[model samples]
Target: MKLRNWLTLVFAAALLAGCGSPGPPVDPAPVGDVQRPTPAGTDMSGQVDNSGPAAPECNPRASLRPDDTIRPGSTMDDIVKRGYLIAGVDQSTNLWGFRDPHTGELQGFDIDVATEIAKDLFDTDDPPIRFRAINSGQREEVLKNGEVDIVVRTYSITCERMQEVAFSTVYFEAAQRVLVREKSGIQGIADLGGKRVCAAENSTSVDNLTEADPQPAPVQAANWTDCHVLLQQGQVDAVSTDNTILAGMAAEDPSTRVVGPPLSEELYGVGIPQQNEDMVRFVNASLEGVRQDVWRARYAHWGLGEVLGNMSPPRPVYR
Candidate 1:
């Protein structure tokens, strides 16, 4: 009888405890897709029309004085002291920054650029290069938070982005184009009207698609590789982005080919956090040194000729 009374009291105590009220239901994390921020007053309408944002000249703010470059004892002193260069780069953007599937080693045009910068900073490109693999959405946050010293992953220089980070003088120019399955019958951006088009979220490529004449249904992915998957699965009709990127995707899948005229001009620059103007100048000087035959050899080495196609190197325009 005492044991029964004790059990009844324990049950009553359990009932009084806070396990009775279930909290609000929790949602599962989003897979493959994320909510990307858009500018205030971003047109939600997927309508394509002639009336769209005017295309800028794609010129960045003037670069720092090339003659009087950033000194080693300045901002770069800390990076050297750290013993390794911390670079934020894309690990999936084909010729620009993808890792080799067989060797599992990072290799790309941007990787080469980062190597050159490391060589200049540390006196040897073979030094420890700690790569932080990040996607388009993470670029600004990573730079702003000091998560990386520099970003060299096919990053474009933009007036808006300048507010967050400083960029080296333009080193490469890429033009936006469309990629479609060879048999899809889609010729270009104009042909994408009413079809599903995939572009990386927070990329200017989406904006280009939205401004097309007969709008496509936009599908946003976390990475360009995700868009490639969607295209192969027939979930998206076409993938549109810089031709430099499209070329890399095309190389991966023989069934897909880059089609269409240029949609936008992408000026590639090395991204440095705003706090490190010295690093910016240091990077710019490295670019100037590699601007000639050196960059050409890299483009040829990566088979970027299909996209770059005799493109001249961009000169410095200092602010």
Candidate 2:
């Protein structure tokens, strides 16, 4: 048999073998064609429409100056009065913001950051906060529609996004990279031409992968974990995203490894609504304390130091 055909047969066999025990005795002959299950809201077409209003010509990292005190009648005050802060977050991106399977609770670097904001707003170490699970594409939509007061799901600060939402100062800095199977023979973005690379829909990873010189075909999944799944199933040639996120996926799967040099620098910021400038300032102020006091502890607690290295919190930049 041809190598391609042999690989395909092996892939199909592995899928069938992992589908739990045989439900009942069956005849030797099987039904027609069995298809692979595509994740919900997955887009295999490599086309991504990025058309929109041009972003303002300002430093994306330069945010509103931080104020130590929250003003009366401000967005922060409203959140305080409401008893709990609503934070939009990702429940799948392992280390950044994922649900702990053991405790059935949300915890990660992003969750810790959001908790710091709530603590500052409510003036308590243990603050009342509700985490609303959202996917990559829904981060801006939830903030715009008031579904969540803030989004901390590894949200990168970009000029184009500034038109749609407000952002806090940079809290974490990550670099874009590639993840591939151990023997995939793919070294970096340079080796990806004509191959399938998967990323979450509307994520910076998709945009960066689409713009590579020898671009691969883009496969959009609902989340990064889904991208990891696609890679394991032999559906995609590689997964491309921030090294911070790729580290999480790599930790979960031992057969994969991250390769290539950094493609781009991604500065992460908290996502807030465009109209809520007060809240943005409040978050920035809260981040000032977080960077100094909480960031290192949370990073160590999550064991990110082993994979991501010991890095200081990103220094704040004010407009």
Candidate 3:
């Protein structure tokens, strides 16, 4: 049978089987054999002598302004009044914010960004940044309700999303991609026509796959981990998501690999509720700090060198 016909039959059968039950969660294969790098410890206490006079402290809260106010208008006031910066993030995405088995603390690229922002606010460079776990669908709501001062999840900047929240300058550029078994013989998105594919629910992956020319039937899982499980079980032919995410999945399971170049460009940004100009400015400055320092170091430490490359030393793009 043609691949298309087979996919259609499977999708029809899936619909008959009911389409709303949540799929089982998929965990990445253990990092047992992979020689993962060790995380860089918090050691900024006395290491400054080697780097010369460090850059002027960007923390503005320490000094009082000419008008006798705390640096004119600042988000510091809001944060101080609230007592803590509530950050919304995903704890399930490995290399982004998955919980560490030993400490039970969330760790990833996004988590590092959040910690930097908090450090600037507290002027400690190691302040305690509080994180609130949020799913993809709840990011907007959490920001709108003031449940979180900022969202550092892998949120893409899109026209529709801009209406609900303001976005910082692009911090990381990623692309939609496909992952398949090493011997699956699938080359790219074009070959997914007759194959079953999976992606996280409420993610751009599903939308992009749904709009493909061949229109593959997408299995929406609660998370990419779940989607990976479906692929391993031979229930799906491909898993679609950001190339960075697929890379993480492949790192966990050498039997699977990401195939083909990126399908579409995606720029990640920090999200804040719309009209909060103060919050937006604070976040932009904090992101600038991240781009300048610690960004590359974190990627290297986290084993993301293969995907991010030299993009780590971020060039400033102020708007």
lDDT of each: 0.81, 0.90, 0.74
Best by lDDT: 2
Task: Locate the minimum summed-lDDT window of 10 residues in model 3.
Answer: 59-68
Model 1 weakest 10-residue run by lDDT: 39-48
lDDT of 1 by residue, 1-319 (tens): 6999999999999888857778888999879865455333333344434354544454474667554243557777878788889999999988889889999988899988988888878876477788989988798889999999999888877876776788888888888999999998888888888888888777788877877888888777778888888788776799888888899999889999998889888888889889887788788778888886488888788888865577667777776
Q: Which candidate do you rate higher for TM-score, 1 or 2?
A: 2
Question: Which regions of candidate 1 deviate over 4 angstroms?
Answer: 1-61, 67-73
Which has the higher lDDT value, candidate number 1 or candidate number 2? 2
- TM-score against truth, every candidate: 0.80, 0.88, 0.74
In model 2, where is the ten-residue run with the lowest total lDDT? 49-58
Which of the two candidates, 2 or 3, achieves a greater lDDT against the reference? 2
Judged by TM-score, which candidate is best? 2
In model 2, pairs of residues that clash are: none
CA error at residue 292 for candidate 1, angstroms: 3.1
lDDT of 3 by residue, 77-184 (tens): 767656678889988888987899899999998999888888877777678678999877688888888788889998887765776777776677788999999999
Give candidate 2's whole-model lDDT: 0.90
